[model samples]
Target: MNVLKRDMQLLKNSNDVVLARQKVRQWATELKFSLVDQTKLVTAASELARNALDHGKGGEMTMELLVNGSKSGLRLIFEDQGPGIADIQQALKDGFTTGNGMGLGLGGSKRLVNEFSIESEVGKGTKITVIRWK
Candidate 1:
């Protein structure tokens, strides 16, 4: 895979989440993603960014424009160094939440993208990667 561009932003607050959404939308538009596709990617990015901030205490988001043969995709990586999840399966289940959220962030994000993967350790951190193909 070849990365055309890469950008990283800090997810420290609610404003940062908004900025992350704007950045994702901008990259999706640059890649000529359709309106619906762009919305899906942006929504997923927002949720992940918020998770990094709220649940993880703070983290970072990385956006990459990728090219592989005839396929082009936007990939997002969210990483946080906080008290990590103890049960990823339960966290991924819809309607399961450790906070005040409705518990759709992880599962909903997965449904919005073409690819999704998550890794977390009990006391280490969490990293979630998602890709939206065009």
Candidate 2:
């Protein structure tokens, strides 16, 4: 297989977050991902989308369909120009949050995906990428 498709969705507000989740689920299902895989990917997309809105102020998410030989996968990249994470290690720890809500977004999303990575600059922004293979 090869790269099937790529899409970009802006996460400027709450509604975009919801749409992002729906799009991720649709893409997962279109690729014939298992129910469990679809759920995991969708859940992770929601968390990241919300983080982009609440923490990053606003951002965009890019979804990609990847294929290699007989295997295929979904990749999502969330980026924001808001104040970047000050401490990435601390942020990745479960139960660590700067807001009122429970701090499960980053770590939990990572756990739900087959691959996870994050990068941030204090005054710049943050970028989180996650991928799930099928």
Candidate 3:
């Protein structure tokens, strides 16, 4: 999938998020992601996808699943071209969700993976990448 895709105005609801997550899980499993790590990757991808949908309004998301062929690790890249984030530090803080959730989305996702990175620009968009090792 090249980790890059575009969807039309999918932020209109939350159900889309569920579907997207499921798809990511299925794909990860097929890609040889360990059951345990698959869950983490899928969960993180889901949360971030929802974040992109919820926050970006509507934009394309790029995802990447990297395999070192030795189970060294896998990476997921998600990018959205919507409104950019201003305070990266504040957003990364625990319980910092701007939405109705507990704000643990980012924090929890961070704990699930070994490496996490997010970059955003005001009036631009946001990009999040998570890496997990086997």
On residues 1-134, what C-alpha lDDT tens digit does candidate 3 reach at each position? 13223222243457766766776676667667778888888788778878888888754444455555555455666667778888988887898978899998888888889999988988889877777775
Off by over 4 Å in 2: none
Residue 11 Cα positional deviation in candidate 1, in Å, after optimal superposition: 0.7
The candidate that achieves the highest lDDT relative to the unseen native structure? 1
What number of clashing residue pairs does each candidate have, in the order they appear?
A: 0, 0, 1
The true-versus-predicted C-alpha distance at residue 111 of model 2, in Å, is: 0.2
TM per model?
0.98, 0.96, 0.77
Give the poorly placed runs of model 3, Cα more than 4 Å off. Answer: 1-15
| Predicted candidate 2 versus true structure: per-residue lDDT over 110-131, tens digit per residue | 9999999999998799999999
Q: Sort by lDDT, best first.
A: 1, 2, 3
User: Would you list the clashing residue pairs of candidate 3?
Assistant: 3-63
What's model 1's TM-score?
0.98
How many times do residue backbones clash in model 2? 0
Better model by TM-score: candidate 1 vs candidate 3: 1
| Candidate 2 RMSD computed on C-alpha atoms after optimal superposition onto the true structure | 1.1
Best by TM-score: 1
Candidate 1 residues lying further than 4 Å off, grouped into runs, are: none
- For each candidate in the order shown, give its overall lDDT on alpha carbons: 0.96, 0.94, 0.72
